[model samples]
Target: MKEMCPNCKSNFAAKDINNINKNSIFIEKQCPSCNKWFCLNKTLTIIKIIGIFLLLITSLLNIFNIKSEYSPVFSSIGLVGILMAIIVTFFGKHETVK
Candidate 1:
């Protein structure tokens, strides 16, 4: 991804390493040209979805191997998670704060 500095309007390559959150919860970067800051929330990651269901919940729904009576419900939730991730990753807006 390329981010443009709001001050200088110069584009720069985006890297996860540029994030500055001490707890590693956000993606933060500063423009090399103007030294301005930008940040994006890390809520769109598919890994977070996987962590919630497959890893943390230890559910078979992740692998499409659900055999329980709640299989349909679990499947729906998984599909929603995938859709949300894709939309957030591509079309989500950026926010800046002090």
Candidate 2:
């Protein structure tokens, strides 16, 4: 599990627990935005997964033309939806809080 740093709010990826127990569950992560260290949280990972899944479903529905309406408007809407999903899925990373 990751926790966001209460100070700078930077996102730090946590490595699976190994032999090293730092006595603290968290590590100091450098914030790309503010250059400060903060705790990372596992919630971010969950959110990213859910967002991508929804994006994939919408994109597939658009690709197969599953809907009965195959009009130009429908096609355009589908294309736009797919594009938006891709963008959000790939680049919707949360920025470090400053």
In terms of lDDT, the best-performing candidate is 1
lDDT of 1 by residue, 18-42 (tens): 5455454556667666666655544
TM-score winner among the candidates? 1
Model 2 spans with C-alpha error above 4 angstroms: 1-40, 68-98
RMSD of 2: 9.2
Error of 2 at 66 (Å): 1.2
Lowest summed lDDT over 10 consecutive residues: which window, candidate 2? 16-25
TM-score of each: 0.57, 0.33
C-alpha lDDT of residue 74 in model 1 = 69
Give the per-residue lDDT of model 2 (tens digit) for 1-98: 44333555544444522222234433334544455544334354455445556556656666787664644555555556556545544454433323
Clashes of each: 0, 7
